[model samples]
Target chain A: MVYFDNAATSFPKPDGVYDSIMKAMKEYGANPGRSGHKLALRLGREIFETRELLAKLFNIKNPMNLIFTFNCTESLNIGIKGILNTGDHVITTSMEHNSVLRPLKVLEKEGIELTIVKGDYAGRINPKDIEKSIKKNTKLIVTTHISNLTGTIMPIEQIGRIARDNGIYYLVDAAQSAGVYHIDVEKLNIDMLAFPGHKGLLGPQGTGGLYIREGIEVKELNQGGTGSISHLLEQPDILPDRYESGTPNGPGIVGLGAGVKYILQEGLDTIRKYEEELTKHFIEEIVKIENVKVYGPLDIKEQGAVVSINIGDEDSSEISYILDENYDIEVRPGLHCVPMAHKTIETFSQGVVRFSFGPFNTHDEIELGIKAIKEISKEL
Target chain B: MVYFDNAATSFPKPDGVYDSIMKAMKEYGANPGRSGHKLALRLGREIFETRELLAKLFNIKNPMNLIFTFNCTESLNIGIKGILNTGDHVITTSMEHNSVLRPLKVLEKEGIELTIVKGDYAGRINPKDIEKSIKKNTKLIVTTHISNLTGTIMPIEQIGRIARDNGIYYLVDAAQSAGVYHIDVEKLNIDMLAFPGHKGLLGPQGTGGLYIREGIEVKELNQGGTGSISHLLEQPDILPDRYESGTPNGPGIVGLGAGVKYILQEGLDTIRKYEEELTKHFIEEIVKIENVKVYGPLDIKEQGAVVSINIGDEDSSEISYILDENYDIEVRPGLHCVPMAHKTIETFSQGVVRFSFGPFNTHDEIELGIKAIKEISKEL
Candidate 1:
């Protein structure tokens, strides 16, 4: 199958993910940390191992600092909700996916202050715009590392430095960038990092994490069963346990550890180069179509692996339907869950069609996909 | 492997669980409801199927109110954090698992009025005591349907009526009771029901759900992707989506659905009878051992499938360790994450040994287990 919807969730996970998932089920798949049985102990160790791998992957100091979540949305929710309080000010960019924008909107309605710094039409958020938006009470600044719709990488290091110099916490939502590209939390000075396990991380969809740099404390989003403190009625002040409640997705997280190992083995730099080449080639070929309008940064170097565009006279939904029914190709259509970005790029009423490429997507598949689009565009 | 720890999370799931998990993964594992794609549509249907099954099982009015969660802890967290407010009065029992207690404790410290009613020695909280504890400001009451540590079934129907008469919302933490017993949400007037997917539901470990009755609102606990309203910043105030944030545990939930199917096919009443027989026989046989003393209600019809006990001159840990290493019988030691329940039973630091039976357990296994405990008592 031609799986182009990696942004939704990477299809056909790394080879290790399947085996690890099955192994956990077959061996000792107990409710981790809830019981003192041997199986539960083994399961607990695997949960910790996954955290350690995530820590190493993200360059976190302590594995406990890594907060496991249901997905990137949960992580971002915890990160945003934990830090941004009522009467607090925050800044984010328009290029963010709905996951970032929606939470901020909720907070804004709750008497929290927010400023959405506009990214360029190319989908890149400028550090200066973010810096200028910061108010005296701005406690946190959040931006997507890569635009999910356009694949535009933000200059987050610059923003991180600005936030640091101004004594503000900088959070990067790395949903589309993690594992597909390099992210050094230390050098980036990212106060908190939110990412998906199933996306670039190649873990199962249920796994995700948040990295809070040592001291930043968020309200416990969910609290129960860390297996440590049975006496405490309230939330623990501990790192991962503070955020993580209930029995974790042990089998799913163990699979994620394998996904992390795959990334380390293959190296993110190599994958980035491959994705860049594919994006450049796909862009060069797609531009030849007479009625197609591509969005975001034109150059592959400045772009993310995703491509959002519209074929004239065709709404994104109809195009998406034709792509699946006629061409046997899969691509996400509509707002891609970011209405703000669509309105910003003037695709508000009719959302743009999104085709995101993953590491496994070959140029041959892209050729067939483009051919199908061209066939539809000719009539348009 | 005599998998005796079903209360921790039932293992060796019914055959249908694996099939459903694989089927969902192969057929409709798109990021559920995020797109208009056929796969997403199918995925959405499957998610709804699980919700419907859960609603049917609990005798709930609307399946949409059944929100998917990571585990029971998450369900309780959502239920508690969403509804409980500062200065609002809340009532819970001392027998609750940490999931319900911890979040309430946090609220307690934050100046929420909390009243902890004692369970009469059997971990059984009297409904009259609960009614007496309700203050004029009491907004909600949360209690465990079945004690996690002692397996005592609380008087939920009576408590439910009291909460209804007093105009207070009542929540039942059904972590240990879901499929092993039947619950009628409407009949009992349970405003919200929290359950673990892995236990009586017979699903994978990571899955669980919260069932909220119609016309109820809890604060949005986690805010992220609901896949329905991409334009909204805050969570949609619908049923499941309002509480369930992020990409859900699709495979685990798929397995959860299959597990529930197995329970429905066999019949919850039949399954409960099978477990009760096991619990009774196990209790009867173990009593033959000279030094054995059982905890919780001795009546099999009244309590659950769990059997907690202490043998004289033998520490629970030492007995549990010997059982696993020497006799290949698995059971949980330590505090069972319910210190208050242990205190109620006077076990305290010396936690009782727990032998929880399930649908898969056999009479021979129970005999071997009892004999092994007999040997351990002899050695002690």
Candidate 2:
């Protein structure tokens, strides 16, 4: 079977990821930082190594600034809700996934002003529009680096410049771009970047992180036994520990380290280029079909690996089912938990079927995907 | 190595746990409930099965009321902070862990009235003290089933009765007593139960759960893509979906299910009995050593599978180091992240060394641990 739902989660992670997780669990599956034994210390050190690796990958100066979370959604929630207050205003784009939008919506009910900058029909968010939305009370600018629906790469660098110039905090959700894209937080002037480990990073699920710039104080979302300052009933005011509580996913973080190591060894640009080629080929051929209405920039320069399309106003779920049942090809359909993104591209009712390419997706598989879509479009 | 940090996290989980996690990751590690594909459907079904297994264990009638969390800390935070309002009052015990105390302390500053019922010198809380502390404005009663530091088992059944009689919600932190001890939510009148999957349940790290009784309304801590409601900007008002947002620890929960299955197959009584015997032998022998002050009820019927002791006024860390370095016995020596419990037992300064046994611990290991303590006592 061919899998093309890399946007949701990347399957068939690197062999080292699986091996590292197994070894960590079988050999030293102890609670890190909670005990004083060798196994616990070893696991704790290994978890730090993973943090350092992610730090290096994301160009973070201090590893402590990166806090591991359950998923990017949690990271996004923390980044969005931690900084904004009742009177604070925030700006975001329509291209973002529900992870960023839903949190802002909830905060809106609590008197936090929200300014949603609209995107074009192709799901492209202009930095100028975001700047225009800024008010005197605007405290944050949050945008997705890559749109999960249309794969439209937002101009985060320009938006970051605007935020830095205005002294507003900038948060970039790199859920769809972390491992395969080059992101230098300092160069981009991003105060916080939230990323998932299981997608382009090729790590197992249950691993994600948020990198907060040093000296930027964001209130923690959860407080518990941080294994430090245990004598105090109050939560510790330390980096990472201030945010991370209880026992973390030790082996899962070790696997994430292996994934980052794999990416560093293979070169991020190489992996990105390979996935881009597959995406470009699939998009070029599928758009030629009679009834297919492909979405996104349709250019490798303006898009990531994700591509969405519809067949003659067909329900996205039905077409996805046909692809899965008849062609043994897997793809995601419907709104993808990003209703605003669907609305931006005028596919809220039709709900485009999304085919996302990963590092492991071969050119031959892309050809087969194009063929499957061609046949399905003809039938429709 | 003898692993006696089961209260922190259970090591060497049942072999089926590891195998099930690997199979889930390699075979069907897709985003469950996010995409409409075979792999996603398979994983979603398996996750529901785990929920059903937990519901059966806890006697929860509706499995949908159970929500998966990252750890027991998050569960406790949700259960504690979800129901309480600004003017509401809460009653808790001194035997609670930092997971319970820290969140309540945070709320105490926000106009929430908190009354901490002090436990006795034995780290045991009297149900009568809790009953006396209850006020007319009391909205919740929180307690730990077993003390993480002293292994003192609280009278949760009696406490639950008091909470029920007063129309107050009862939240049980079953961090140390989830899989080994029987927890019938309905019978105990527990409105909410918080538990860690990696502890007594013998699952992998990064998995935990909170079971909210039907009709109990608790606000969610995080909101994002729940995959159920794609169009609504608001969080879906569903049972599990409202609380569980974003990509969960898929394979981790599968391992947890395998762990619950192992407990069910081996019989909870049998597992509890074996652990109890180990605790009884270790406690009886260790208490006989001179200069060693054991903290807990010390009786098999009163205590669970945990024992804390200190040797000859020695720093608990030094003795724990000797045990790890000289005898290769793994024990935790510190406040155990429960400062109030240590203070209640009058060992706050010289924290007692904690020896927690799990299902995998044997009589031979217990004897070895006793011998190590005996030799250490002679040296002191």
Candidate 3:
């Protein structure tokens, strides 16, 4: 099957990732940092080396500032819940995954003020709009680096400058950009960044992390044994141990390290260039098909690999079903967990079919995918 | 290496667990519940099946009540932080892991009243003492099924009955006892139960779960997109989705399903009996050595496989280092993330060396471990 759902999670990960997980479980499966034995200490060092790799990839200064989480959603929750408090104003865009929008709404109900700037029809957010939304009480400016629904890349660097100019904390949700596109947290002026290792990093599921800048503290989201301060009843006041509160997914983290090492070896530019060619070819060919309407910027440079479209008001799930069963091509359907983004694109009730590409996706697969959609459009 | 730190995390998971994880990743690593496609739907079904297997093992009537977490510590945080409020009273024992004790301390500092009853010298807690500590405003009664430091089993059935009799919420942290011992939540009058999959369940690390009884709602600890309520920003008030807000550890959970299925087939009594024999024999031999002092009830019927001891006035870490470097045996020497339990056992600053056995441990390995400890004591 030709899988085009990399936006949800990348499939067919680098071979080293699977091997690393198996090696971790079979050779040294002991709990890291929870014991004083050789295997446990070795596992702990493996975890730290992974942190260093991530720090190098993201231009983070201190590796200890990175905290491993279960998923990008959990990282977002920890950032959103840890930093914001009552009566503080937060600025965000209408185009965001429910991971960002839901937590803000929960906080808004509890008396936090919110300003949601609208993204254009092409799902692009203006940096000036974010700056204009700021108020004296504004404590944060958070935006998704790339819209998951339309793949429109936001101007996070410009927004980051605006946040710095205002002395407010800037957070970039890097769910769609971590390993696919280059992210230098230090250069981008981003104070907090959340990313999923399973996606662009090509790691297995259940591996993700949050990078919090020094001097910023979010209230602990989940608290327990960090394996550091066992003598104290209170959670330790350390870089990651303060925020991280349990036995980390050790095997998953090791696999993630392998994935990131592959990325570093392959070079981010090479991987991004490959996916870009497939995405550009897809958009250029598919728009000529009869009665098909596409969303987001048609320019490949302005968007990530995600492409959404509909066929003459056909329900997206129905087309996706036909594509899966008859055409043997897997594409996602529905709102893609960004309902507000769908409303902005005018596909609120009838969601659009999403075709996302990965680094390993070939030109042949994209050609087959376009052929499948052309056939589906004719039937509709 | 002879691994004897199964309480930290069981090593060499029963053969099929690693294979199941690999199968999940290679065949269908799609994001479950986030889209409507063949792979995603199949994965969602697989996750549901895993939940059913866990429910069957714990005697839970509703499979949806079991929510998978990163570890048992995350489960405990979700339970403790979710159920308590300011001005409410909570009763707990001193022989609890920091997973339970740390969260309670955080809550206590936030104005929640706390009463920590002391365990006896043998690490046993009297049920009447717990009942006497209850107050009119008591909202939660939480305890560990077995102390991590000493392996002393708590009177959870009696405590569960008391909490039920008083209409208080009862939570059991079964980190050390799950999968190796029988735990029927319904029969024990348990309102909530937290367990780790890596310990006795023989799954990989990063897999654990919490079972909340029907009709009870704990505020969500981590909130984000659950895919079902995409139209609304507020978190959906659903069973598993309410607490589980992120993309789950699919491969790990599938591994956990295989692990739990193996336990169900092997019979909990058989596994418990094997570990019991190892623990009983280790204690019987180790105590006869010079300058060795063991903690916990000597009876195998009253404890788990965790055995803690120290050579007279010798730092446990030095001996553990010797054990690792010279004898190639793995034993944990530290606070074991349960300082209160260590304090109760009179090993606060001088922590004991912990040698925990698993079902796979053989009589010959125990004999070797005993000989190694005897040699270390002679050097002391």
Candidate 4:
């Protein structure tokens, strides 16, 4: 099947990731950092190595600041819930995913003040609006690197500068941009970054991570055995252990390491270029079809490889079903987990069908997908 | 390697568990419950089927009540922190794992009244003592089904009865006993049950679950996009969705379903009997060696397959290393993530080496492990 749902999860992960998971399970699947045995120690080192690789990729100086999580949702929840307290103000954007928006909404009911800056029709958020929303009570400014619904890249670097000037923590949700975008956390002054390993990272599901800059403290989301300081009942005051409290997804993390290795070897710029070519080719052809309207920044350089479109007023789910059953194409429909983004793009009720590209997607697949969409549009 | 660290994580999972994970990853790795494509729908059904199988195993009438977590630690944290409030009282045993004890300790500092009833040297808690500790404000009684450190079984049946009689909620941490032991939550009056799928269930790592009885409400541990109720900002008040946020660990849960299927086909009673025989044979032979002292209840019927022993006061880590390096037998030493249990068994500083048997373990491996320990004991 032609899978266009890379935004949901990148299908057909890089070649070595699956093998790495199987090898880790069979060769050294012992619980890491729990026992004083060779297998446990070896597995523990492997996890640490994965952390180091992530740190290097994100320009993080210390690897211990990266905490493995089940998904980007958990990482965002931890960052949002751990930092914002009662009576504190948080600044976010309309382009944010539900992961960030939902947590902030829950906190809003608990006396925390929330200000959502509106995104433009193209789904891009102005950095000046984020600065204008900031108040003396504002403690944090969080925004997504790229809008999942519109694929419009936000001005996180400029917003990060504003947050630093205001003495507020800056959090960037890189769920859509982690492996494909050139993200230097230090250059952007991002204090916290949350990302899913399965998407652009090309890893399996059940793997994600959060990178917290040093000197920033996020409250422990869940307290339990961290395999460190077991004698003390209190959660240990350590970097990663304080935030991580469980038997981590060992094989998943190992596979993530392999995925990262592949990305590093291929270079992020090269992969980004290939995906951009596919996105540009598809958008350039699909826009010529009658009654087809596309959302997000039209320029490939400004947006990600994700493009949302609608044929007349067709229901997104129904269009997606036809694409899958009749055309052998896999694309996601509806709100894409970002209800607010649909409202910003004027597709709240009639959601747009999304076609997202991955590193492995080719020119031929994009052309065929466009041809199928052209046929579907004619029928509509 | 002869793997005797089943208490940590059962090694060489049931035959079909790994294959199931691979199949799910290749065929149905789409984000379940997130999209409307055929792959997503098929995956969502697979996850629901897994939930149904788990419900049958635990006698849960509604499968929606069970929430899948990254591990048992996350499940215990959700149950512990979700229920207890300030000024409320909670009763737990001294033999509980750190997963339960650590969360309760954090809550204790948050103004919850915590009463840790001491257990005997045999690592068993008396149900009468638990009853004596209950107060009018007592809201919950938490205990581990089997101690990770000593393998002594807690009388959850009597504790459940006491909690019911006192109008208190009873939570059982079945980390080490879920698959091998028959746990009828309804029959035992268990209000909540937390267990790891990777242990006796013989699934891959990164899989575990919590079952909340009908009409019980526990605040969500992590709140984000649950695919359902996406239009609303507030977390949807739905079972499974309410407690489970983030992308469900699809491939890992599929492996867990396969593992549970194997257990159902083989019969829990048969699996339990085989593990019991292994435990008895290992214990009977190990006790015959000079200078070897064992902890926990000596009776096989009253305990699990895990056994903790020491030789002539030698450091447990040293003995475990010798076993792993010289004899190729994998065993866990040190606190085993249960520091309180070690203190209760009088091995606080000098922790005991733990030998936990699995369903695949044979009589020959146990005898060889026992002989290796005996030889090591003679050297000491």
User: For candidate 2 chain B, which ten residues in a row score worst on lDDT?
Assistant: B280-289
Over B1-380, each residue of candidate 1 has an lDDT whose tens digit, in order, gives 67788888887788788677766665566777776677777778887898888888998877887888888888898888889888899999999888878888777888899898988788888899999998889999999989978899989999999999999999999989999887999899999998989889988867888888888868776666676677656567887777777788777788899888899999998999999999999888887778888888878867898889888956788888888888878888778778888888888878888999889999999989988888878878
Report the CAPRI category for model 2.
Answer: high
What is candidate 2's TM-score for chain A? 0.99
- Model 3: per-residue lDDT, tens digit, A294-328? 99997888999999999988999899889899978
User: Which stretches of candidate 2 lie above 4 Å from their native place?
Assistant: none
Whose lDDT is greatest here?
A: 2
Docking verdict class for candidate 3: high
**Position A25, candidate 2: lDDT:** 96
Task: Flag the better candidate by DockQ, 2 or 4.
Answer: 2
Candidate 2's residue-wise lDDT over A105-211, tens digit each?
Answer: 99999999999999998999888898889899999999999999999999989999999999999999999999999999999999999999899889989999999
* Chain B TM-score of every predicted model: 0.98, 0.99, 0.99, 0.99
List A-chain TM-scores for all predictions.
Answer: 0.97, 0.99, 0.99, 0.99
What candidate 1 gets wrong by more than 4 Å, as runs, is: none
- Identify the leading candidate in terms of DockQ: 2
Q: Sorted by TM-score, highest first, which candidate order results?
A: 2, 3, 4, 1
> What is candidate 1's local distance difference test score?
0.84
iRMS of candidate 4, Å: 1.0
What root-mean-square deviation over C-alphas does model 1 reach?
A: 1.6
| Candidate 4 lDDT score at position B297 | 92
The CA lDDT at B250 in model 3 is: 85
Candidate 3: tens digits of C-alpha lDDT, residues B1-380:
89999998998898889999998899988889987788888888888988999899999999999999989998998899899999999999999888898899989889999999999998999999999999999999999999888899888999999999999999999999999888999999999999998999888888899999999869887777787878787889998998888788888898998998899899999999999999999999988998999999978988899999998888998889999999999999989888988888899988989999998888999998999988888877
Output the better candidate (1/2) by TM-score: 2
TM-score of each: 0.97, 0.99, 0.99, 0.99
Pairs of colliding residues, candidate 2: none
